[model samples]
Target: MEHRELGNSGVEVSEIGFGAWVVGTDWWGDRSDEQAVGMVEEALDAGVTYVDTGDVYGHGDSEEIIGKAIDGRRDEVTLSTKIGYDFYDNPQAGHGELPKELNREYLTEAFEASLDRLDTDYVDVLQLHNANVDEVTPEVRDLLREWKESGRVRALGWALGPSIGWLAEGDAAVEYEEFDAVQTVFNLFEQEPGRHFVETIRDSGPDTSVIARVPHSSGLLNEQVTPDTVLEDGDHRSHRPKEWYETGWEKVDAIRFLEDPDHADGTRTMAQAAIRWLLAHDEVASVTPTFRDGDDIAEWSAAADVPPISEAEYDRLEGLYARNFDIDRDDGMDVLRTSVDGEDIEAAGLDKRAASY
Candidate 1:
């Protein structure tokens, strides 16, 4: 896998990284602890050097599994984990969001606990998990810098969301230029804030790298949830409206040209193509697709080696996106949670209704 540095932090990450959320929680599906470790091992064997996990994931279960999976090969990967959510004192009610504490005292405690779970002295990247714009105070900034200076954290970042639509928070992070990376839900289908952030970096000059998560647009771009496929109860994707998948499948069919072998770069699986599309943006440093199993890792880990999306294909995609993939129907994502009364979303030119979280 190709490695790219996160901004100028000197922390390199694989082009295709493993998002350990799948294993940490049954949000995707249930997998035994052994199976989770095996999947991580599989990803490492396939040359994936970036593994991202959050302390809130199964209340640190994901990090522990990742630590076990990477035992004795710690130097071989660029490890990143997020904090901010205080799941310790709060009970997780299904997929309900938890209270976040970004104060220096709480964050310090959380970071130390995370290290204990991962069995590591330090992490390459430490991010604020789903931090609201106001939560990124000067005190938090000082704490992040302190960690970096203390050699406990190599880089600092802000991971956006419990879901998509944190445009204002992402923009503020880029403008602050304090973070090495900003992780978000960005893909061909849902390109609002990600596109906005990339342009913000280009037009201005933060140099903060973008980490594209949920690159498959919740399994649509990867064809994992086909039109006829039924999502079981408690599955995270089941929360999305049925119309979302219907519209997504239609859009996926329209982009099949990306899989044609006649392209100069050669053919690509829909999954790889989805990742490649994100990499086409210069600001994107990594794409962390949720790997469900060993086969999922094998196919996506090689995305860096596939023929890249050519300029023409990219333009075609932009055109399709401009026209809403030629389908005149709502994708059920028009309204998104916003912290600043939708002012930020409006400023970003995203035509979605802003709902208070």
Candidate 2:
């Protein structure tokens, strides 16, 4: 595995990190704590030094499991966790929305809880989950400054829509203050990020990179994304059944149909092809592709090491997209917040900021 700096935080992590979401709790039925911990240890062995988790993941179970795995090997990895609103912060999308504001009250409470659960005094990067940068008040900024100054957190960020990445354009709160890192879901299926998150790093100016999660779209990019595939009942994906089976496969179906072979263009398996599609984008710093154990690690890592497929393959994918593929049509970033937004780019003066990236 390769390593890169996570924004300007001065922390270098494995290019491919492991997300602690699956290991922490029973988001899907039941999971073995020992098995989850074993996976964490395996991730470290695979050179996956970065781990992303949140207090709400499995209700702190994920963070706790990661804490145990990184207990003594603290120096070997970079740990990231989120506080504030839960996954279902949106009232409609309401899974874990806390009925609170992000004032000093929530920030402090969130941080302490996250740290305690992770079994660490300080975190490499601490973020607010599903936050709206435009709405981030002055008080929240002050607390972010305090946390950094106090050395309790090396950096501050948000894990939401790609649109929130556009928030950096506005002279508002943490976004302009130079957040440490932001985690967003960007894969071959959904590829429009404000790219500044990693391009800034490539340019070597205040250098901010990304910790991309769901590089596979909740397993849609995986081999089993066919309509017949069944997801575990408790999976976070259980809520988005339409996205899982019926609606999310324009790109995947297009590419697979055109390519024909499972690992086409000499050695591009569907999963590898999907992973490579993201890696090929210059803006992506690294990704946190998920796995269950050591054998899973071997497969993804192998995918990363494979040589790039031929131009004929690229043309095939391009032709397929032109003929059958379509861009993401879900325009509900407010409901499903992203770290960046395209329309807001001009609104927030991010068009000029966009140029810098």
Candidate 3:
């Protein structure tokens, strides 16, 4: 697997990282502990050296599963996890609308709990889960700095929440310089915020890395969902409007050129093509593709070996994004209202600036 340094932190992570959100909960489906651990082991065997999980994921069950999976091979991977949610008090905060708590006492206690759950002394990368731009206050920055100085976390980042492309937060993260990376939802379909985030980091100083989550456009790029497909009740995608699948498939078909072997210069699956499209950018440090089982783990982990999409193909995608191509361009702010129950965008202090397209 090809590894890249996470910003200037000197922490090398595999091009394809393991996303542990699905395994920890039935949000995707009911996965047994053995099934979850087996998948992580399979990912490790396939050369995935970075694992991204959150404390709120299955209410810390995800971290415990990871702790067990990497029991004897902790050194083989760089563990990255998120905090800043009060999941400890209210485990069922509903999807994407977890209450934020960034005070020092809350943060310190949260870090300790995460370490205990992961069976590790220090997390390689610690992130503020789903924080808004204004939420990343001076107090939060100082606490993260203290954590780094005290060796609780090697590097720090902001994992944009309620969906990707929080332009204000992404810009502030890069300018802050304390952040080593920023995680966003960047895939073949949802490309704006991730693209803008990468450009801003490159143009600015501090060498912040970009971690692309939802690299498959929530399974559209993964080819696991079709227009006819119906998601299960517990599945996270089930919450999205039916229009999301109908419109998403249209957008997916528009980018079918990415899957052409000739354009890719070699044989590549649609999913790998999607991931390589993101990896083509020099600023993307890692792309975490969600996996369901050992087989899924192997398939995505090998995506890193596929030849990159040519610059011409990359430009084609850029042009498609510019045209919008019948895709909804709400800047992903609708995610806050639709994905979670009772989420108030205005109450969250998110307005036009936060959802700038």
* Structural similarity to truth (TM-score) of each candidate: 0.98, 0.76, 0.89
Cα lDDT of model 3 by residue, 1-357, tens digit: 999988898888899999998778887778789989998998998999899999988889999999999999999989999998897776474565667788889988988899999999989999998787666789989889988898878888888865554566766778887889989888877665677777777778547999998888777888898866778766777766766667777888887876665653567788888889889988999999888877677777888877788878878777887676656544333432222222323434443233332
Point out the higher-scoring one by TM-score: 2 or 3.
3
Top-scoring candidate (lDDT):
1
Residue 75 lDDT, candidate 3, scale 0-100? 92
Candidate 2, residues 1-357, lDDT tens digits: the string is 766766567777766778777786555346688878888898788777888888877667788899898989988878888877632343423244454357787678778888887888998788777666655677777888888899888876667642324334321222355575667666654443434344544555444555567777666777645677676654666656364355566556666742344344455567666666666654455677877567667777666666554567666765554443565554222232223444455553332333211
Alpha carbon lDDT of each predicted model: 0.89, 0.63, 0.80
What's the lDDT of the predicted structure labeled candidate 2? 0.63
Q: Which pairs of residues have clashing backbones in candidate 1?
A: none
* Top candidate, metric TM-score: 1
| Global fold similarity of model 1 (TM-score) | 0.98
**Worst 10 contiguous positions by lDDT, candidate 2:** 330-339
Off-target runs (Cα >4 Å) in candidate 3 are 91-96, 263-265, 326-357
1-357: candidate 1 lDDT, tens digit per residue: 788888889999998888999889988878899999999998998988899999999999999999899899999979999999999999999989999999999999999999998989999999999999999999999889889999999988899987888888888778775699999989999897889889988887646999999999888988899977888878888889988998988998899988873667467899999999999998999999999987788888888888998888888899999999999999787776788788888877777788877
lDDT of 2 at 322: 46
Ranked by lDDT from best down, the candidates are 1, 3, 2
Q: CA RMSD for every model?
A: 1.1, 5.8, 4.2
